[model samples]
Target: MNAVAGAVQALLVIGGAPLLTGLMRQVRARLEGRAGAGIAQPWRDLRKQFLHKETVRPRGTSEVFRIAPLVLVATSLVVAVVVPFVTTGSAIPPAADLFAVVALLTLGTVALALAGLDTGTAFGGMGASREMTIVALVEPTLLVAIFALSVRVGSTNLSSIVSSTVHDPSRVISPASLLAAVALVVVIIAETGRLPVDNPSTHLELTMVHEAMILEYAGPDLALVELASAMRLSVFLGLLANLFLPWGVATSPDPLSLLIGTGAIVLKVGLLGVALAVGEVFLAKLRLFRVPELLAGSFLLSLLAVASSFFLA
Candidate 1:
């Protein structure tokens, strides 16, 4: 039953990621008074790239450049399967440790950063350097923020933390929970290349962070990179939703519960994506040097959350 739930969760995340990206764009467009390319545009774009474009290898690039996409996608898939999006029980329970999950995500980021460096392009190396800087701050905040939640539950297994939340809903309203939520929100925005951290839509060399690394990729490789990115955004949003709002997630692996959990996660993640898009409309990208300040602030919030959780317990 856990396996089935994991499979369903992976399918939903993989299949719905593109739609989620499109929905955010559509929301942004409407807010800006534009008709926008429809909600299916990302899907269409992915399909067209996959079917019509040829994968191109840059001259002098190493095997890291060739295999980075696979590594990114694989790590995302592992995270999707292990995370308790649809159910409290992970298919691979042993691998569902919060540290393990964070490491898997970091691995994907490292893979892309290494690939970026391997390209030997100035933009790629710059992006990789900037990405690593962000990662250094983001990862600790992520762990500590989640640690704030795990403090109450006495375990760092994501399933355990979430399951505990399910049983004691009042914990969600605690000061620790609130602080951690805010901290996680910041890290998620940073981790996913959202506004105020890095602009996903911009290709200008000065502003490029995530986009610069992939400028050397084309066709199928680009498609894979894009797909992995969409998946990462969905994964982060899903993690955010489930961590703070674990109400609709399944406590048992029953069929009806699993179905409800699936729907609940989709709704929660969609609402988060929409909220992020709306917020982005008003936010300008932070200057490259100032990005660390925002992340540092989030890290401070996470620390406060941890302190509050322990002291107030």
Candidate 2:
């Protein structure tokens, strides 16, 4: 049953990613008073890219460029499985350690950076440089923010924290939890390339980081990268929803309960996607130099979370 449930969870995250991306696009379109593409638009886009023959295998690029897409999607797919979607615990509960989850995400990001540099294009090199800088700054806060939760719950295991919160309820409002939540929100924005940290919509040479890295990829490679980006977005949102807002996440495999849990998971992810769309709509892209400042602020929130958890405890 765990195996079956695991399969379901993986497909849930992977298959649902394109839809979420499309929904964000649709929401943005509506806000701007334009007719949007279909809500399933990303799936069609992926299919079209997969069939196109524009794939450019740059002459000097190493195996890294060829393989990064596989690694990126695979790592994030593993993350979706480890994060409990309909359950308070994962199918592989031991892998639900929050630290390990973050590490896996970092690994995926590193693969993309390496691939970017391997392509030998100016845009690729610039993207790789900026990408690593952001990763380097955000990772520490990400690690310590988990420490905030670990300190409160006595384990870095995400399942334990969610389960404990569900069973107890009071811990969510603690100064420590609140501070960590605030810090983690910032981390999520930086890590996901949303809002003031980086704009997902931009492709300008002067400011683009994420899109610049992939300027050389096309066809199936581009499709894979795009799908992976969408998957990562869903994974981060799931982490935010399932960890802090664990209300309807399942604690058991009972059919009736799973239905409620699934519905709740959908609702939470949908609302969060809406929030992301709204943020993107209202917030102008941050000046390139200001990114470090935004991430630094996130780090401070995380540091304060750690201090409060220790001192307040």
Best by lDDT: 1
CA deviation > 4 Å runs, candidate 1: none
**Candidate 2 lDDT tens digits, 69-160:** 99999999998887777777677877888878888999999999999999888899999999999999989988887688778688898878
Q: Total clashing residue pairs per candidate? A: 0, 0
- Local distance difference test scores for all models: 0.94, 0.85
lDDT against true structure, model 2: 0.85
Q: Which one wins on TM-score?
A: 1
